[model samples]
Target: MNLNQYIDHTKLGPTVSLAQIDQLIAEAIKYQFKSVCVSPVWVKYAKEKLASTNVLVCTVVGFPHGTSTTKVKIYETKEAVKDGADEIDMVVHVADVKAQNKKAISKEIKGIVKAAAGRTVKVIIETAYLEKKEITSVSKLAIKAGAHFVKTSTGYAPSGANVTDVKLMKKVVGDAGEIKASGGIRSMEDAKAMIEAGATRLGTSSGVSLMEGEKINGNTTY
Candidate 1:
């Protein structure tokens, strides 16, 4: 497989600068990555920067934490799409899953999906915060609620993507939606593992090193 096509070259740090985004965009263009995942604030800039390129612009909503209210997430999704984000990765409210409120969880995802217009919506289930059953349940709910993808992590959790989790997620999503393995994928081995496990996309900040075949230490990037 073409690994670069599977990568969503990401940089979602709280302190991401224009210079960093420029570098990210440059590398993305050079490597022909699938997309450049950035925070909402940089979506428009990234969009403009890659206007002539095929790299899509992706942005996160209610990132790291899935505690944002549905209304807020919907608004955030709308703004992101308006800002030229081709895809929106929204964190699902894990509290709803813990509370067994599948309705609320589905409702939140539907709201974001609707707000996303025709753009793609990837629901981040934050697997580290949920039980195995909860992961399957949320994955089903996300697909039923119209999400286009079920993502594993946000890279800000206590733990990130694991091959086991990715495999389980693929089992749940099946053909209903694609899976994006994010979080702790830092090496070529890690990347290959996730894809082999059924990941259609990957979210990581180590795209440059990954392309150059370097093994990085930390999975610190988005």
Candidate 2:
């Protein structure tokens, strides 16, 4: 598949405004990116902006923190979908997963997945906070919970997706669910490495820069 075909050109931050989202949608339209992941508050606007295009509107649930109650996450997921979000990226309950409360973690994921109603739901395990073994176990729970994809991070963590983490996640989920390797993917080389590591999707804000990097420096600048 084309590398750009796997990219979700993301630009989600508190500093982002409606004007910025307009620019983002314009960029997504220009690049023909696979999707545009935005904050939930602007999902409606994003949907409206991209209504005429083929791009999908993706929103985050539980956001950078994955500690929200299941009810709240479900509510958020439902609201996003209602607002025209095509995909929901929900964070996993890190504490529950780390404490070995598999039931609670699975329950949380299942609730959100159910609320998504078979829409593209990607469970963000936030791999930055877990060990390799934890990543594998959590991925299994995410898949078992009926999530369509297992995502790496929220991009607000101290670190982001790594080649090793993607490889581990891929092994756990196998061919059942997609793997979304996000965060810190700033170059085509980095994106390629992750794809080789089994990442079927990439979430990155540096997509333009990565495309720029694809330009060889054989000649002088214009």
Candidate 3:
């Protein structure tokens, strides 16, 4: 497997610096990763740096937590797209999922998808906080709402991607949408497991390390 193609080389930390963003762009170009996922603030910078490269620029909306209003998330999506973001990864409102408020969830995702224009939108379900059934329900809703992908975590939660969750998400999405296994994936073994379970993209801060074949020892928060 060409792991580089599956990676969305990420650096979403609140304190990530310009130098780090430059490094992330350089690494993505060097390794030919699929995309560089950064915060909205750096979307333009990453886009500019990777303009001549194949790497896409991805940015997050309603990150870490999905409590923002639908309007706000939509605005974030629009601004990100305007700033040259090629992809949008937006967190879903877990409360809506927990409450089984399918209407609200679908509306929010649809709003963001619309705001994203034609760019890809990956819905982050933040699986750590949901029950298996909720995960399935939200994954279905995301697909129905036009999300291009269903992502596992925000890396700010208690846990991250697990094979079981990935498989379950795949079962729900099937051919309608793709899956992005994210967070805590620190080793080649972990990455392979996610892909085998049906992940088409990976969001991680450990892309370079994984490419170097180094298995990290501790938890990674995206």
Among the numbered candidates, top lDDT falls to: 3
The lDDT ranking, best first, is: 3, 1, 2
TM-score of each: 0.98, 0.94, 0.98
Candidate 2, residues 9-117: lDDT per residue as tens digits? 8888889988888888888888888899999999999999899999999999998788788899999999999999999999887887788899998888888888888
lDDT of model 1, residue 102: 92
CA error at residue 26 for candidate 3, angstroms: 0.4
lDDT of 3 by residue, 6-54 (tens): 9999998778999999999999999999999999999998888888999
Candidate 2 at residue 70, lDDT?
A: 84
lDDT of 1 by residue, 22-63 (tens): 999999999999999999999999999999999999999988
Residue 202 of model 2: what lDDT? Answer: 91
**1 or 3, which is superior by TM-score?**
3
Name the regions of candidate 1 deviating beyond 4 angstroms: none
RMSD of model 2, in Å? 4.4
* lDDT for residue 10 in candidate 3, whole number 0-100: 95
User: lDDT per model, in order?
Assistant: 0.91, 0.86, 0.94
